[model samples]
Target: MSFFTEIQTERLRLRKLKHTDWEAISYLRSDPDVNKFVKRASADTQEKALAFIEKIRQATETNSSLYWVITKQGQNQMIGSICLWNFSQDRKKAEVGYDLHPLTQGKGIMNEALKAIINFGFNTLNLNRIEAYTQNNNTASINLLKRNNFKLVIGKQDADNLENAVYELKQP
Candidate 1:
């Protein structure tokens, strides 16, 4: 169950996750270097990865979440994932989370994906606010959010209690 077909960026295409993506998904969500800053337990095994995908797919079908596998334009290889989830009751707010393959890091791929999704949230979805939580030590993510004008909300905390800094981008 996919909501939108895909979201395209200059260098990447964000498509709905498929069962075939299990291998890449497992690696991205399980690899030590990749999940170092991620709080969830690793999806190291095929079963765990498949279960995770099912969860995301169900959420998407229910219109409660949207997750996309990130791939390069000319390359079908999945290099990462991004999602808008944890929606508020009124459906006007959501949290954004993303990851990129280590090899693709520092190349601004995630940055581009972020911009496109943020735009979709604001313009297409008509969301009033979009939020993100990143580990305080995850400087790259913090910097990327800042560059996109997502301001840190002092003293505000996520109910999830993951010990992350909360940032918000309000609709313009």
Candidate 2:
């Protein structure tokens, strides 16, 4: 199965990242609060944003990975992004990541989006395991993973200079 596929949930739609989404995506990625746990991107201009989007498009086209823009049903606004990165050739596992706009925090939007992505990973992609890592201080994310049935495997200091809590869920 193709890794890149649109997924629709009751309250959200996970669609491919498009060129037109750069403007909003740029803003989201540049937000300090939102980018705190994420690796910093050097996208300082529209051209860079477009280039980044194109790279994501190419990655999806090749089925190397998947990056999706999360939007609410009936609205074109991008509330966040859900991604499955570093896919293995064996196709048994992947690293999951997500981020939401600060304005939308505390609304359970991310929790809903994560559920949709995990369901897609296990049911659609037939992946056996999905894993996520969050900084130890990110209680919200840790709790979200726990609520989604991801067991905390352990905590370790990452090369990025943060104590990360690793969580994983295996398909039943």
Candidate 3:
């Protein structure tokens, strides 16, 4: 598909990321509370945020990845973002990633979004396996992976020599 395939869950909708989502995306990518474990370049500036949105859009158009802005059923505001990308050449596997607004933390919104994305990865995308990586201290993320039947896989250390846990869910 030239565009992202939208998905809907019980209480959330996974739609393609739009330029208007830059503000929310910037907040999630820049906030220390949310980016504590996500180690990427600074998206704290408007320029960086615009570039980030373009990156996702290009990835979707090229069928290299799928990124979705997660919103509540009746809400126009994005509470978070979820994606399945970093595809293996054969497209049998992909890596999943996500981030949520700090204000929405402790709610089940992400859990709901992830479930739908995982389903899309396995079913529509016909992927054989889906994987995720989270720092050891990210208990919430690790638990979410496990709840979705992803098993912990051994991994190597990062450039900083810090270890991150890898989780994988295989199609049954």
| TM-scores of all candidate predictions against the true structure | 0.95, 0.91, 0.94
Tens digits of per-residue lDDT, candidate 1, 27-103, equal 99888888877778678999999999999889999989989899999888899999999989998999999999899
Tens-digit lDDT string for candidate 2 (12-44): 888989888988778787877887766668666
lDDT by residue for model 3 over 1-172, one digit each (tens)?
5747778888888898888888888898888989888787778888899999999889999989889999988888988999998899999999999998888877898888988988888888899999888888999999899988999876534444265777899998
Candidates in order have lDDT scores of: 0.91, 0.85, 0.86
The RMSD (Cα, Å) of candidate 3 is 1.6
Candidate 1 local distance difference test against the native: 0.91
Ranking according to lDDT, highest score first:
1, 3, 2
**Could you give me the TM-score of model 1 versus the true structure?**
0.95
Q: Between the candidate structures 1 and 2, which one is better when assessed by lDDT?
A: 1
Task: Report each candidate's C-alpha RMSD, comma-separated, in the order given.
Answer: 1.3, 1.8, 1.6
By TM-score, who's the top model here?
A: 1
lDDT of 3: 0.86
State the weakest 10-residue window (summed lDDT) of model 3: 154-163
Clashing pairs in 2: none
Which candidate leads the pack in lDDT? Answer: 1
